[model samples]
Target: MPESNNCCEAQGLDAITAKSHMDESIKPTEPSLIQQVIDNPTGDGITDTNLRVPEGCPRIDPCPAKAAIQTQECETEKGDGDNIALERARNAPPGPLGPVPTGHGENVPLEYWTPLGDLTGTRPAVENFSLSRFSPNEWNEHNKKLSAACHDGIQVATTAGFNALCSISRAYAEADRNQMDNNIRLSTRAGTIHRWTVELERMIADIIEEIDLVQEVRRRTMRVKSVLQVVENIDKDMMRIRCFRMDNDLVRDQVSEEVTKELSLCEEIRDVYIRLLDQIKMQIEELITAKRRVEFDWSEKKEAYEIETESRGLGSQSDTILWKAGSTRIPPDQSSPSGYEYSTKQVLAEGYTAKQRSSTLRVNVDAMIEKAVKDLRDQADRVDLTLTQQIQLQEQALRRLEAELYKDLQQLSDTETLIDEMHDASKKLDGAMKCAQTRLDKRLLRHGVENCRDVPQFGLIEEVKSLSESVSATLGQLKRAENSTSSLIQSRRDIEKEMVVKRPVILTVPYYVCDRRSYKSNAQLEIQSP
Candidate 1:
């Protein structure tokens, strides 16, 4: 205490016992971000016991006339306690209602008043000074020479201190949370854009091979070559699956797996159909050749039998049957030479019997030829039906492919649009950042620091730094979108770095409301460190 030269005067302690801590003379000021971060919640510098606070704390009466005055030796033992400064600050003018009417202009608050206790040194015109008229009375009635109004010794009322601290702390904490959330949101958006761009570009690259396959299939499909009257029904399919990505990883995996499986099935079906068509063509050709052979031989034999019967005075026996249209086979029969015919029919009676037997043979063979032709027609019909079904299946597959391709195309279109939007935002942010940088450079130059490192940073410098960081992050994201597949985790780290600026944001709003005031050049106006 060292005699506590800065102790509250007896005349100035009355308001601490009567009014609010936020006195009119002491307007609320912004909470200092630095202070809040450092101010421990453990306790204020005071006794822990509640009982020792408002009432039981030692009374600091500086008045020499007070009956309970402590000895000088007792004051020398307490050391230089800050309570001396606190008490003086709490009770000094301007009074709680505002500036007291001094013979001079208004007196400034003690905290900002220079030279530690004398205000007349700064403003020589002020006359009714509080320092000159010290008194033991609340109204200075002990002398009745100074003003009756006075400030309080309590910076905060004991009963209301807890609530005020809690409210202010909450406001700062809320601001911190909001700023952190904004940083997180920006990171998430950046990551999403990056992931989509990478995925889309990869898909577009992969699609080249699929397009080639489709073209190859198209070249071979439905083509009949080399005079083989063979019709081909090849299944041609191209699968393209494009989808807009979301944050749902599990869903994306499932969709990707499913699309791959279905496309594979389409290729397998195409292969099976191609093999089936080849087999069917070979089988049909064999059947058709057999039928053609049987028809030709039967026709030759039937004509000979009818001629022999007519010459023997017997009625004509026309047992010949022709092959049906669209026959898939040819007969293998050949005409018999004259030498063989005569050798087969020796002696007149034997020849007549042989003729009858020949007629029977001709009829039997003709019926066989008709049966072969019927079989060929039936097989061809069945193969045609099967081929048609296969063709229908192929067409259906093509349609499904087109649908998927359409979706892929739509996804590509959407991704391109998103990329464009990102570029536009990047350009806008770049321009704004450049402007902020110019302003910062000018400020630094004015402060005689060409480099930002040499200057002491304030709100403007911090704002510029913050904008630069945000711009850099966006540019990084755009770069990744255009050409890189860098992990988005880096973006998250960038966001965390950005969050460092969030702390000061907590006190910014309150400062504007509580500390903001118009410029005043009055000698008594306090010069705050804004």
Candidate 2:
């Protein structure tokens, strides 16, 4: 505990807090006229060469800009610092926690520990202890109090102390486990730093509170209500645990540095995340647009196809019966020609007969419409399949992102695993289609319709082109993310290796004061005699 306390004090996290505050208070220096014009153009044909500039040089028309060399501009959208953040985030970790808030410089507030209440025993004062302070009667009284309190009042403290230790230990362990477990999560939208902050802070706060509680018992001022008061003071307690105490400061800083490295990686991954997310969204929209085009256009195609089917007298040829209205003819049920069932020779012969005909027969509208419908349906199916596949991929990427690439970004095996998981979303889409078909089939029967197959009208040439373009864009975005993620993962590994410090385990607190005292009754007396 003392060692931990000493490290915290020496590390001076308060100094970090003070320095950040000072940095925030300073104003940005305005760029010169030449520099402003040079930095103003984003190469999008947009330029701002205004010579008259105000202090800090507010963004001018057709140009979005921040001061080029400001330390505070590290996270600016187009700043070199942000460009460098992709690589240099871990080089200079932020103080307290989180990214620097825009126009604000508040560090993470420290959290406190609360002790359990109604402790009904006294702790023998150990301050300035000497032989004179422990005469025979006083020593006996203290011995009894230590023994009685050890069993009685100290049970709560012991349990509380160990509980805090176990809690913080598990909290730390969980953080490590999560880093591994979250590898899959990093690939998807569900990935976040919020979980890291929440768990890390709780563990650190509990450790600080445990330390404070130990200090209290050692000083012989342990009281349930006082402990509650300390814990209840949110701001003060938070400061005590998070920012002020030396022990608290060191552990927080050490853990914060490691976690900060992780956060930096997450930010880099987020760069690819934004691009990938945007690309995926565009792809999904294109697919959805293609699907809707099919839904509306199919009805018209179906009508034309059925008309042509009837014109060719295919009613008698189909598996299901389809009769035209006002035709009083009751067509006789025709069986297959004798001995031709299950015989491929007969079918081949029929095709040869048609081919061998001397006359050049005209191509029928029936065949033409059928071919068009078939092609349309094929394109629709392709759109649906590709759309589903892209969505699954996006979700998987977010999953891996949330899990963190550090855990799951292995060379080839992980890629295969992701590809293997690709068929699930399509299956779900198929089940939905089946349900729709069931309902549609009933509606058709009620309306006196029969043997009409679903088809698409116009071939979705424009939509297909659009969809293809979106898929290509999405692929490019994903490739970039994957490539960047690979490098970021390696960087994270390096940071952890450099900054990680193994935390010591905290066991239950010592109970009886005499358990730590000398057993010889005359030892104190003899020392005093000297």
Candidate 3:
């Protein structure tokens, strides 16, 4: 062999020897990266160096066909080296790798991996190895891109969340507004109900008062009717007695001294009867007048009572009516003339002139005189008898009249007593009404006149107070019920909002092993691994 050739061969063998020694060193230490990553995956110094070749590797000696042989060997070795690196990477735990050199172990560049383990030990070499190198500037640039993407995603999610929250808030606000409106409606309804109730109560009270007044009026009328009936009965009895007396005196006659004396007695009796009849009639008239007066007074009082009751909204059913009858003396009628019949002897004794008598007797002498006198006497006696009988009947009628008069007087006396009693009763009633009015006034003064001012002469204020209290209590209860109902409705709405409406959201990425040929074929690659 030539010296130069030998020298070249020796140099080539030396290179080979150095590469072999380097390969041996790398082969033994290569597994250390995997072990180190596995033991402490998140350790600060741990990296992807375990998948990369070491600092030294075996090389070939030079030959006459060294170029071709070297090329073939290089191609085979490169293929084998890539396979070994891929295998190592597949088995190696994931971490940031150091820089990779271009030619051999020195060409591997540094790379980065996230905390989440993303490597299969058999990962292919990146086609853009320079692009894959883990320079601080590049890493920062990648982090910025990732941060931007994450920020965009976060912004989108936040926008969506904000819109959802706004929608929910709007719904809640609308619901609250609706609830407020409902409450307002309920309050209005309650007010209306209270007003209606108060009106109804007032109407009812008015009706009751009117009914009571009617009843009171009815009672007063009945009382007055009874008193008037008594007066009518007394009047009828007086008329009957008068008629009987007049008829009895119309059918009697006689004339002797005894008859004349009896006639005188009858006349006296007639006078007494006439006087008695007059007294009875007078008494009747007086009683009627007094009763009318009492009725009139009662009517006036009733009117006053009604006025007061109406004005005060009070009932006058308990008021009373009182009446009485009275009597007066009756004067005799003096327009009609009266006369007495006398006997012949009685007439002569009255001193008629003798010439007149002689002339009166000359027509028939003694017989004629006797006949004329006797006839006159007979006529006179008949007249006397008639008069006497009339008088006697009159006397009996008079006695009956006197009895009627006495009865009438007694009735009048009783009526007077009744009148007195009625007057007393009227006074008492007046006093009571006055007292009631006074009490009412006092009550009004104490409680204020707003309620009672409309009443003209109202009676008792206690009654009004009681009625008002009842109405107020009822109104209060109605208000309470309305409030309770409103509250219940509000609570129901709140429950619905809380329990039936309003829910959280979750995102994922997957790990993939890339094919080196596929990665190398394109400048940019999109892997669809789901």
**Candidate with maximal lDDT:** 3
Per-model lDDT:
0.37, 0.36, 0.39
Candidate ordering by lDDT (highest first): 3, 1, 2
lDDT of 3 at 474: 48
lDDT of 2 at 25: 39
Q: Candidate 3: list runs displaced more than 4 Å.
A: 1-82, 85-153, 168-176, 225-530
Report the backbone clash tally of model 1: 16
Residues 360-393 of candidate 1 have per-residue lDDT tens digits of 4334433433443344334434433443454454
TM-score of each: 0.23, 0.15, 0.20
Q: Which stretches of candidate 2 lie over 4 Å from their true place?
A: 1-244, 247-254, 313-530
Question: What value of lDDT does candidate 3 attain over all alpha carbons?
Answer: 0.39
How does candidate 2 fare on TM-score? 0.15
In model 1, the runs with Cα more than 4 Å from the true position are: 1-359, 445-473, 476-530
Whole-model lDDT, candidate 1? 0.37
> Tens-digit lDDT track for model 3 on 58-103?
2211112223323533553655454454344345444434222122
